[model samples]
Target: MRYSIEEMQDAYDEINRKERPLVAFGGALGGALPAAALYFLFAQIGGIFLPMLLMPAAVIGIFARYTGFPYRLKPRIPIGILAMVFHFAGCWLLQLNPFVYLLGPVCAGVAISVSKVKLSRVQEFAIGRAEIGKLGPNKSIQPTAKASAD
Candidate 1:
């Protein structure tokens, strides 16, 4: 049975509301772990530039995952700005090279732009599952195979 758009939307909204807290925690943890590892690894090896190159990428990738693809400027701009602020602050505290300060916004922009190009299949599957769960199973319906052309 087909469900109305409103029904589907409500289901999605409900799911999002319920998952928001968990998603936020997961995003933060996911972003932080790799970044911390990279920072420590680079610090031990005396490689400052490598962490500058990779840390932002890790954080931005996790941010993109939680925020969804097809990034809109209105929503993402503030986030990008916030990330830049944090990056600059961290750099200042750590006494890192000033040149690397620019990497944060650049990485944020690239990640946001690339994310807009395509939605991941996993996201599509999750959305489909949510909709189907809302609509309930139709046991009466049976799958059928189409005849192949010889």
Candidate 2:
């Protein structure tokens, strides 16, 4: 079936506003965690650029949310790869321990790699799932036509 302009817009919007708990988790691990962990572990020495990994993670997160999909290594290939180098360099360059800053890109990438996100109720509705209404108005199973319409 063809999609109306409004429906198409809705779909685009849904894609634009997809869930991204992974990015949040990644950010926590890549940005805040490494900074705290490295600083703590090395007693405030500049560790690898572990925190830099959070940049890609953040980018991936925001992009994933926009596109309604998980991070793609192929699409973000260069940056994704460079993230690793940055992490390593941040540690050595900054004189921070590589192990301590291990929470950088690697952790963020892994975190984003395996995150699951559920669509919003509005999205479910737009995708043809019927709203049962507030306070559970109707929960009964109906005829195929009605069910199919929804």
Top-TM-score candidate index: 1
The per-prediction CA RMSD against the true structure, in angstroms, equals 10.5, 11.5
Cα deviation in Å at residue 117, candidate 2?
Answer: 9.7
Q: Taking the tens digit of each residue's C-alpha lDDT, what string does model 1 give over 1-150? A: 565545555544454454443344345445645655655555576646634654554475455456443223444444445445555655665567878776777755643453232334443444675556633233222346789999
What is the C-alpha local distance difference test score of candidate 2?
0.44
**Candidate 1 ranges beyond 4 A from true positions:** 1-30, 50-54, 66-70, 114-117, 120-150
Point out where model 2 deviates above 4 Å: 1-9, 12-80, 110-119, 124-150
TM-score of 2: 0.32
Give lDDT per model, in order. Answer: 0.50, 0.44
Per-residue lDDT of model 2, residues 1-150, tens digit only: 454435534653564455344453444334434444443454354342445445534543344433435333343333344344545554564565446566665744743453324555444444453323321214333334545555
lDDT score of residue 19 within candidate 2: 32
Quote each prediction's TM-score: 0.46, 0.32
